[model samples]
Target: MNSNFDDFVKQNVELLDQHIDELFDSDSTLNTDLKMMMKYSIDAGGKRVRPLVLLAILKAFGKTPNYDILTVAAALEAVHTYSLIHDDLPAMDNDDLRRGRPTSHKKFGEAEAILAGDALLTVAFQWISSTNLKDRIKSELVLSLASDAGASGMIAGQLLDIQGNQRHYSLAELKHLHHLKTGKMLLFPAEAALIMKPSKLQVAELVKDFMANFGLAFQIHDDIIDVTESTAILGKTAGKDVDLNKNTYVNLLGLSGAKEELNQVLQKCEQDLTSLGELQPEMDLMILEGFLTYLK
Candidate 1:
């Protein structure tokens, strides 16, 4: 990754950490154990990809990062963290580690981890609504987040993923599954940023197209990493996908094929970004481009 992205990521992550930490402090009604588990997972290391992507998209459109942006970013991260906590449960992917630490369930007991996930998911909306942004903007963000993280989105993807163990899915079917499971959250950043800047609504579809390809490329990269990286490097159990018999790009397409597909998807991302640049010359796409390059 480029130095610019590295610096942006470091700065934003610290800011987000502060914002998320403050959320619990202001709430007098949070249970101690529940708060501990939530903080455990939230403070547990993650790349904060969703928040970074959302902030990056807003930056591309000339919106400076501020407390309000941090609030929205924190909300996005909350939902993502909740998903990770739940996804690692015994009933789900049954992971034992995440981001190089004991999985939430492993560290906090199954019931506590479950409640922690529940708390994070529910409070994410509260964070959004509590933001100082206009009500319309806040509502739009909440709606986008809900639809993306809800039953028809990531949940559907998870359901399909579990069921995929029973049968081989066509490539198209796999894409559809991931488009919900992974793509929608990635897509939400772009959509949310566009919502914030109605002036750039004309390129909404173009931006969504870019994020769609980016999201798939991300998942493909993850599949490749699962096979190539070690448990230590991945910060999670390596080859778990294979152990779980989950459907993945690497399984459906050979390693070389998956790499080839990743390249193709990234190339599409570049094309989409270029089209956006053509429409809005002032938009800084270097950070966005760096994201694609980093995935490669």
Candidate 2:
């Protein structure tokens, strides 16, 4: 990644931290345990990629940053955090660590962890609905998010994951599951940002294609990490997929093949970005590439 991207990432991350702190800091007065649990879940320090990507998309269109933008982006992060909380449950992946800290269930117990996820999910919609953005813009984003997070999207992907454990899926099947699970969330930000700047509609098609490829590439990189990195490096239970005998890019395509596939996706995303032909093309590419710095 370039220094420019590093700076961009730093500024956005700092702003995102403030937004999160202010938003959740108010909830601390509600119920001490639930508030602390909320803080624990959000404050555990993940990448904050979902919100960052939303802002990046908006910046690419030269849209001025606003509190409303941050508010909506925070909504997406809440949904993502909720997903992680539930994913670590005993009934799910049963993970014990996340971002190098104890998983929510381990730290807060299953009942509280479950409520925390519910709270986070509801908070996401509340943020969006209460935002002062135009009603049409707000509704579009909420509807897009609903499809991505609900039964037809990530939830369905989770169902496939649980059922496919210890089972092999063809390449096509794997991509289908991932498109639902990870790809839709990535696309949601792009779609929502375009609504804020309808003039970018001409470029929206290319952005969609870029996000789809990038999302799959991101997951493949994750699979590679599980196989190659340590638990300490991953900040989560590494190689758990192998221990669980789960299907993954590495299992289906050898390590070398997975890397090759990742390269293809990156190349495709680059092509889509270049086709955008706008002032922010370089920034757009940098934003995408910076996320994959682990590959370097």
Candidate 3:
């Protein structure tokens, strides 16, 4: 929410873009079409929120990255972008646009889009493997990434989400679903950061809570935006959930109720950050505040 946090995120985006270009080379040994598709989707505008938050949290803990943070961040962005590519497929959300342009499948054809996503997913681990951190730390990050982005996490949440269409979900059920589908990837930053720089147990717990609540708040904001924003403003199809008859916080809780829940989560997120008092807390708290504020 703060100007400082905004600057931090903006700077991180620049870093992420640079790293992606280097890591996902357009002139590599891969087929030209596949490379073009991959580059197109990756360069498609995204917030790079995951890596920024991860870097912020690590800085909060009075630690610098164990390796080139931008490269590591790019790895996560690859995963996130890959998810978007798959999500926009005709078999998935059937989206026609993303980041203000044609969806990968729409731009490159479905088969090429699919391969592009696959390449990005594989490249995520490849980037991680290429990192200079210790083997244990590298393994921890890779394993956490797999767990968060894989079947037991985002994939499972997506399955639950698809099945949840046409069915009513209690607030608890909705939270659980988003926790997996959206929260895990969002939480990955703080989780991976904690592993990189082992903070005190209490700090670790607070960080988990903060990231979890932030993740939920972020998703709720998205649900609200889908209902309230125009497709042009969203740079992606808006109200696709409604079109698909999918369950969402806005539908279940009503817009006001959803906003209320978001505030509660945000208050808790702020409180968690508050507990980390002093000891170079200003920058970290500012980043978190900016992260949350930017959501609105």
Candidate lDDT scores, in order, read: 0.89, 0.83, 0.83
Candidate 3 worst ten-residue window by lDDT: 276-285
Best by lDDT: 1
Please report how far candidate 2 places residue 54 from its true position, in Å: 0.8
Ranking by lDDT: 1, 3, 2
**Estimated TM-score per prediction?**
0.97, 0.94, 0.94
Q: What is the C-alpha RMSD of each candidate to the true structure, in Å?
A: 1.2, 1.9, 2.0
Writing each residue's lDDT as its tens digit, candidate 3 over 1-296 gives 35677677777777667777876574367677777787898888877788888888877766654445666777888899899999889988888999999999898899988989999899888888887888898899899999999999998888888778758788899899999999999999988888888877877888888899899999999998998999999999888877766789888888899889888888888787788664335435666667877666
- For model 3, which pairs clash? 1-289, 1-290
Ranking by TM-score: 1, 2, 3
Among these predicted structures, which one has the highest TM-score? 1
lDDT of predicted model 1: 0.89
- lDDT for 70 in candidate 1 is 85
TM-score of 1: 0.97
Worst 10 residues of 1 by lDDT: 195-204
Superior by lDDT: candidate 1 or candidate 2: 1
Runs in model 3 with CA error above 4 Å? Answer: 64-67, 278-283
lDDT of 3 at 190: 87
